[model samples]
Structure formats: structure tokens, C-alpha cells
Target: MTAIKAADSTDQAGVWITLRESSVPVRAILAGVLVNQLGGFLQIFLVLFLTERGFSAVQAGLALGCYGAGSFAGVLVGGAFSDRLGPRSAAFASMAGFAGLLIAVLYLRDFPLLLTAITLAGLVGRFYRPAAAALLSELTPQHRQVMIFAVYRLAINLGTTAAPLLGTLLISVSYELLFWVDAITALTYGVIALLTLPKQAKRPARPDAAGRRAGGYRAVLVDRRYVLFLLATFVQCCVYIQYVSTLPLAMKAAGLAMLWYSVAISLNGFIVITSELLVTKITQRLPIKLIVVVGFALLALGQLMYALPWGVGVFLVGTMIWTIAEIAAGPTMFSYPGRVAPDALRGRYIASQQTMFNLGAAVGPVVGVAVFRAVGAQLWLWCALATMLGLGLALLGMQEPDTALARRAAAATPVELTKDPA
Candidate 1:
């Protein structure tokens, strides 16, 4: 049994190694994910960015909420765009539009214009999400979906980890430079998508006995188990986002410098980027329910640690604890959408879950900051409680992954790669 387990591990590791080399679109998406995420400076710095410009904390929170709201709406529209326009056009539109609008926001000194630009930037920014996710899902087989999403998240974590430190350096020269770099990188990804992705992935779907499409948002909404999973996911994301939204504010309040917050969050990115793939390989071998429960619990526990004190020690240690939760559960959480959705509506399902993530992002800061003002550091306890609530829902709502059906669907559709112009 030991030998068999070790052999299984080797095969799993090998699969990830070959993933980047497997296909053109996969490689393009991976590169784009990394580049875009690395330059994803605006979201990380928006709160501070606005505060430095003399916007009140509440205003910054509202702007952050707008970004999240834009992302939420963008995902829904992105699903349709992904289906109708194909991955290439959808990604191009998202990236290119986001880049242009982002630059416009940086120039506008008027608060209302700034707020409007932020909202538009957020809206256009996430348009390619469903397309990229659908593309990855189409390329990967069912059993390996977790592995693919792990790689997908690796790009995101690596980029995010670097972004904070990188943004700090850019701001040393000019704050505008940071936004410019972000816009430029976004455009780079857009160009890559236009050149590499298939013109469209949408095609006719086979109707079921009901003479209607097999999947839609309506279908997703009616599914109780999945809806429950999304609810839990929202809370889990709320807990996770606190590190970004509230942690910095708390640290600043405690008289700790931004450097400390940067180091703490950078540590999280480093740990996840360095270890998540290995963690996923092992976790995928475990039962889904066990990981979900422990992961959510640890998330709450980590935040609970923050109730101790606001020193660097508490911050870093707490960050590490929740980062473990992320490693343990990230792959399952990401790939679960692909596992259950019908091929026709896969993008919509991915968007549905992602909307929950955005909902958490949208709501977390506004609520967190208000609570932080009301109760001070006791806010950490509230974060812990919220996570536990999510855990209970996850326990009841999430079901076994439909690996057989996913495997069968993946086999039935072989995606043809788009040839680059000579």
C-alpha cells in the first residue's frame, strides 16, 4: 500500500509538470493569469491609494465595494460573452477595456468621476474570468481538474504575492506608475488572448428530453446543494478577504507600519505559491467533506488569533494559519464548479460561484470596517464566527464531485487550437 501510494503521488506530480506544456491555450491562459495577477496592483492598493489621495476610509471602502460589484456583474456578463464571442474575443474585450478604463480612473481627480471610473474598471476587468475558467475546464480531464485549478491558482498566488512589494516599489517613483503598470499588463494579456484563443467556444448544445438547454443560471439557482455550497463559499471568502481589507486598517491603527502588513500578506502569497500544488495533490486524495470542514474551521481559527494583539507576530502567525486552510481547500473549492456543471452551462456555474466570491469582496470591507470602528479588534471574533457559519452550510450543501460525468463530457469534446498568423 505504501508503494502504491508513493507511485500515485509521482503520477500526480508528473501531471502538473506536463500541464503547461500540454496545449497552447492552457499555456496562454497560464501566462496571462500570471502576468495579469502580478500587475494586479490596483485591488491591493486601492484602499491605501484612495486614502493617500485624501479620501476618507469610508469612501475607500465604497470604492472597493464598487470594484467588487463590478466584478460580480462582470462575471455574469462574462459568462454570456464567453459563450457567444468565444474565449479569445471575450478575453480581449475584458482586458483591453479594463486597461483603458483603469487609466481614465487614475486621471480623474473628481470624486464622483473617480468613483464612476472605479466601478467601470471593476466591471470590465473580470470579463474574461469565465472564459479562462471554461477554457481550462475544457482542456483538463475530470480527475485532474483539481490539479489544473491548482496550477491556475498558482499563477494567481505567485502574481498576488509579488504585487504588494512591487506596488510599494512603483509608488516610490510615482503612484501613477503603479496604475500604469497595471493597465499595461492587462493589455498584454488581452493581446495574448486575441492572438491565441479560439474565436469562440460557444456552439450548439444537445437538448435534453425537455427540449430545452441542459443548464442555465435558473438551473444553478434551483439546485439546493450547489446554492448551499455557494453560501458557504461566500463566508469563507469573507474571512479570507479580511486579511486584505481589514487587516491593514487594524495594523495601521495599532501603529504598525505598512511594511509590516506588506510582509504579512507577502508571506501568505509566498507560502501558497510555494506549497499549494503539493498540498492539492495530497488533499485531492482525501475526502472532500473533511477538507472543507477543517479548512473553514482553520480559517476562523486564524482570524481568531488576531484577537490576541496587533503585533507583527500575531499578524504573521495568523496569516500562516489561514494560508494553510487555503492550501488544504483551494483546489477542491476551485474545481468543484467544473465537476458538477453540464458542459453547456459550465461557464455560468463558474460565474455563479465566482459571484459569491465577489459578493464577499464587495460586502466584507464595508461591513468589516464598520465593525472595526464599532468594536475595534473584536472584529476578529466576528470574522471567526462568520467562517463557522459558512462551515455549517458547507457541511450540509456540498455533495460528492461527479467525476464520472465530468470525465465523460471532457472526453466527448476535443477543443481545436487556434493557429497563430504567420
Candidate 2:
């Protein structure tokens, strides 16, 4: 039995090792993503910075909300750019624009100018994802798409883990230094992209291939099943954001120390980094619909855990449960749009998905805090119900990924111009 278990573990380890040996462009993109996340301190610190500068809590909250709204807009604009200009140009522009806007934010103290700077910064900053996602899809084989996205999530988790500590140290030195350091990170990513990523000619106008449409955002909007998927995604995301927004407050209300809350967050990140890839590998062969359903079910279960009697053990258990849900759902969720989208409409599809995520993120804190305050601990039960609803919609509305429609769309995709440099 011991030898059997050991062999299983070894096989799992080998899966990760093979995943790490992806092509050069994929690796480069992952590295840039990691570096970008390491300096992603502005969103974390913006509220505190504004409050420290004598703004009221309400004012600071409004600004942060504006930033989220900007991110939503950015995703839409970025997706359009990715579809029209190609991923390389969109990425370069996002990073460079983000750096410049961050600098503008550093110097501006007045409320109006500062708001504009941060909003534009968010707009530019978010452009990277659709472009990056499109590029990765273009570069990777279909069978490997989920695993590659798992690596992308791992990079984000690892960088997020390191960011808070680094941001804390820099803020102690000076808040201005924090902005400058973040700007430098964006600039660095821009430079790396310019030097390493391949350039492609603009996508030439072509008639809609069989099984695909040629129109831009309009095509994405009109897909009835895809729109249903987006709605489910939005609700799940809203439930997910409660972890950062109201879960801590709920814990505090339940008499748990702030330390326990921090520990829960750390555990969440650690679990994602350690388990996401392995879980993705193990579950990659499952139907996408099944994986997503299981994920949402886990999310519902985790939220229900919060409604149990208050205890440190229960809190940690809840955190682990939802962390697993996040791991199970994330790669598959992000990769689905890429897989099913018409090749011509890939960027817009991805962007539309991201827009739903951002919208949920922006609205979550407000709704979470409001519900928690009004209903006290019972808020979690409602959250669980929401997840179950989302799960039901996903089961009903999501199409089978291997259906003829999907296969035809995949076949219709044009050959990518850039050759594998591996």
C-alpha cells in the first residue's frame, strides 16, 4: 500500500514537471504575469492611502469603486484592441499606459485629478489579460489549454502571496515609493514583451468561416448560451468575492481574532499555489460542465461552513473548502471562453467573460457588506444559496464542450502566423 501511494505521488509530481516545460512564449508570458502581480499593490493600498490623506471612508470607498468600474471598461476596450491589433501590441500598450498612469497618480493629490489618473490606470492595467489569454490560446495546443491556464493561475497566486509583504515594507518607506515601484514593474513587463514576444500582422478582414461569425463585440453578445454562461459566472464571482469583502467582518463578529482572518487568507493562497496545478491535471479529462458544477457545489458547501458555530477550526475548514472550489473551477472557467469561441471572436469572448468577472467584483463588496450588516451571520446562508443557483444555471445552460458545434469552431480557426520557437 505504501509503495502504491508513493508511486501515485510520483506520477502527480511528474505531471507538474511536464507542465512546466511548456514553450518559450508561454513561459515568457507567465514570467511577465508573475512580475506584474508582484507589484500589484495599488488596488490593495488605494483605500488606505486615500484615508490617510484625510479623505473620509466614504470618499475612499467611492474612489476604489471607481477603480473597479474603470477595470470593467478596460477589459472591454482591451478585448477590442486584442482582436484588432493582435496580442503583442495590446500587451505593450497596456503595460506602458499603466506605468504612465501610475506616475500620474503619484503626483496628483486633488480628488478629481487623482480619480482620473487611477481610473485610466485601471483601464490600461486590465488590458493585459485578454491579450495574454488570446496569445496563450494561439500558442498552446487545445489539449493543453487547461493545464497552461493552471500555470497562469499559479503565477498569479504566487505573486499575490509575495505582494502584501513587499507592499507593506514599501508603504512604510513612502507611499510614493509604492507607486513608483509598481510603475517600474509595469515598465519592465512592457520591455520584456517588446523584446521577446513575436509580432503579427493585423488580422486581415475575412468572411465568417463556417461555424463562426465575423462581427466584433456584436457576435459575442448574441450567443445565447454564452450569455447564460456569463450570467452564471457573474453570480459565482459575486459569491467568491465575499471572502475578501465580508467574510472577515463576519469572523470578527463571531469573535474570531483578526489573526485568524489573516491566517485564512494565507491558507487560501497557499492552497491555490500548491494544489491548483495538480487538481487541474487530475481533472482535466472530465467534462467541463461536470467540473464547473462540482466547483460551484463546493463553493456552496464552503459558504455553509461559515454559518456553523464559531470556532477557529471551522473557519480554517471553510477556507480550505472554498480554496478547493477556486482551484477546481478557475482554470476551466477561464479556458472555456477560449475553447468555444470562434477563432475570429476569441478576444472579444474572453473580454466579455472578464467584464462579467469585474462587474461581479465591483458589485460584490457593496452587496456583501450590506447583507452582512443587515442580517448578521445569516448572510452566509444566503450566499450559499446564491452559489447553488449559479450551479443550477451552469448545469442547465452550459453546452457540452466536445459537441459538434465546438469541434467545428475549433477547426475553423485559422492557422496562427507565429511559428513555435521551441
Candidate 3:
């Protein structure tokens, strides 16, 4: 369970045991991911269900907004709780609540009731993400942080890929059946997490300096380096939303079918997983910021291709290009924040990032849809391109952390604090 072994984890030839590492940190990450992905399918279909039940687009947006707002609340609350009580307890509580809410969704059909249920579900489910993220950060050695988070992201996308398709098949039979399936998976994950996560996992102690900021959102904001990364991520999320929010309508206008659109999204997730694996192989040698900029450039190029008057073939090309970019950039983005976070406030730092991520996720759809509605398809791709370019330029302005900082931090950390139990 040493850092070296964690870093050198392997599976049988052609099989990556990304989840089966000896480290408890990796195990906990894998477990959390399983839970997140299993229940996450429920999120994708909420809007569709609302629309089917006679809610307007605006109402559906509002309901989702409420869900995001609820998640925001959970991030703050969970950040504090995870920082105080450790990620294991925080995750267990969050999963239990998520399962409870999913079960409640079955009995509630009215808009108000459903909205309330979704909000609660978001609240409960979101609490675990930051906690799990912080836990991974705590467990991983400096050199392997990016790979760890990359693997974590890969697990999430894998779960997302499987769950929605499963829900879709169930939906073909009955939405009620889909709900039941989601509930069962969620509950199962809750039980698994409770059983597998180490009982003794505890929050690390704060750095001693009474005057220094120790925990919470305020502490995270005070770190100018983290703030810069946060700003960069904000812009990235703003632009990334088009894939889900505006891309479908634009493709439809250009004669692509909804089936292809779904294919593109799945492809995007697949490419993201692949890119993360590639990035993990080279991250020690390459600068992560440079890698992320490369990703942004790819995304921008894809958007530009979409802006052109080409047909379905070009559309597929654009999606493939952006898919690679997503894979390259997404894992490093989260991994970097975890690396920079102080051990004591890791929960808060991770939560703040997720908070911003969710905030942008909520705002991106609203803005992308609003812009698409007002201007039409011609402007959509251009806007996405512009956003990507802006983020790339912004990335250039920030200072990149070198191996020295990571080494210094690792040297300073107490061995008893981070060692694996035999």
C-alpha cells in the first residue's frame, strides 16, 4: 500500500485494474464512483420526464435550476461535514439520502413534488463528490494525484455510459421500472460503500497557524493560485455546456438525427475515458496546464468545424475532435485542484471547485439555450469556439506549478498522516 505501489498499479495484460489497487484510497474512490454512476442516470431523464408530464421548457429549466441550487447547499454543508467527520461518513450519509430520494420520486408525480424530490436528491448525492475527491487527494502521493483523479473520472464516465442506456431500455418498458432500477442501484451502492470504506478513515489535521485560514469556502478563495484555476474552470464549463444544451438543436438544423447526437455524447464520454488514460501515462513528463491548453485548442477547432457549412460527416469529425479534447483536459482539471489543496481544507477546496463546476453547469445550459434561441444555429459554434479560445488565453496567463512545489509539500507532510495500513 505504499505510494510506489499505488503509482505502479496494474491489471492483467489488456485489463487495467485501475480499481483494484492495493491502496484503500483507490478502493474508496472506485466505490464512490460506482455509487455516483449507478444513480446518476436518474439525473439525465428528469427533464424529459418533466416535459412529458406537461412542464414547459422554462419550468423544466427552473426545476433543474432548483436541483443545482439544492446541490450548491449540499456542497457547502458537505464540505464542512467532510472536513470535520471524514469523507467515509459524509459519503455514507449522502448515499443513504440519495437512495431515499430516488425511492420517493416514485410516489411523487406533481411538478412541485417532483421538483422537491429532485432537489433533495441533488442535495444528498452531491455531498459525496467533494468528500470523495478530497479523500482521493489525501490518499494519493503527489506524483500520482493526476492519475488517481483521472481514473476516478474514468469510473464516473463509465458509470454514466452504462446507467443512462440501462435507464433508456427501462424507459422503453416503463418509467416506473426505470425509477425502481435507479433506486435499487443507488441503495446497493449505499450498502457497498458503508461496508467497504475503512471504518477508521478520518480527516487530517489543519496546519498550525492560528492566523492562517484553515477551512471553508473563505479559506479556499484566499488561495490566489486556486482562484486562478477556478476562474479557468468556470470559463471551460460555460463553453462545455453546448455539447448538451445547444449542440442537439444545431445538429438538427443541419440535418443530423437525434440518434447521432446521442452517439456523439457517448463518443465524447468514451474519448474522455481514453484521453484520461493517455494523459495518466504522460502527466509526469508533461505539464498539465499545457496538456489542458491542448485540449482547449482541440475543442475550439471542433467548434470551428461545426460552424462551417459541412454535413453529417463533418459533424462527426467535430464531435471526435472535441471528444479527445474533453478526455485530455477534464481529469487534469480536477486533479490539479486536489494537488494544490491543503490537507486540512481539502474538503472545502474540492467542494468549492464542484460548487463552481455545478454553478457553471447550471448557468451554461441557460446561457447556451438562450443564445441559441435568440440567434439561431450559425452563432452557436462560433460562441463555443470563442469561449474555448478565451480559456486557452487565460490559461497562458496563470503560473504553472512545477515538480519542486509538489516535492516540498510531500516532504513536509507527516508520514503517519498519509501512510497505508498494512
Off by more than 4 A, model 3: 1-20, 47-65, 108-115, 169-177, 199-214, 255-260, 273-275, 372-422
- Indicate the worst ten consecutive residues by lDDT in candidate 3: 10-19
RMSD of each: 8.4, 7.4, 7.1
Candidate 2 backbone collisions, by pair? none
Decide which is better by TM-score, 1 or 3.
3
What's the CA error at residue 109 for candidate 2, in Å?
A: 4.5
lDDT of 1 by residue, 225-321 (tens): 7899899988888778888789999888888989999999878878888888888877766666788987998899899988886477888898899
Q: What is the C-alpha lDDT of each candidate?
A: 0.83, 0.83, 0.71
Task: Please write out the lDDT profile of model 3 over residues 180-224, one tens digit for every residue.
Answer: 777777666666667766553444554467424534677777666
Ranking by lDDT: 2, 1, 3
Roughly what TM-score does model 1 have, to 2 decimal places?
Answer: 0.78
Decide which is better by TM-score, 2 or 3. Answer: 2
For candidate 2, give the lDDT.
Answer: 0.83
| TM-score of each prediction | 0.78, 0.86, 0.79
Q: Specify the highest-TM-score model's number.
A: 2
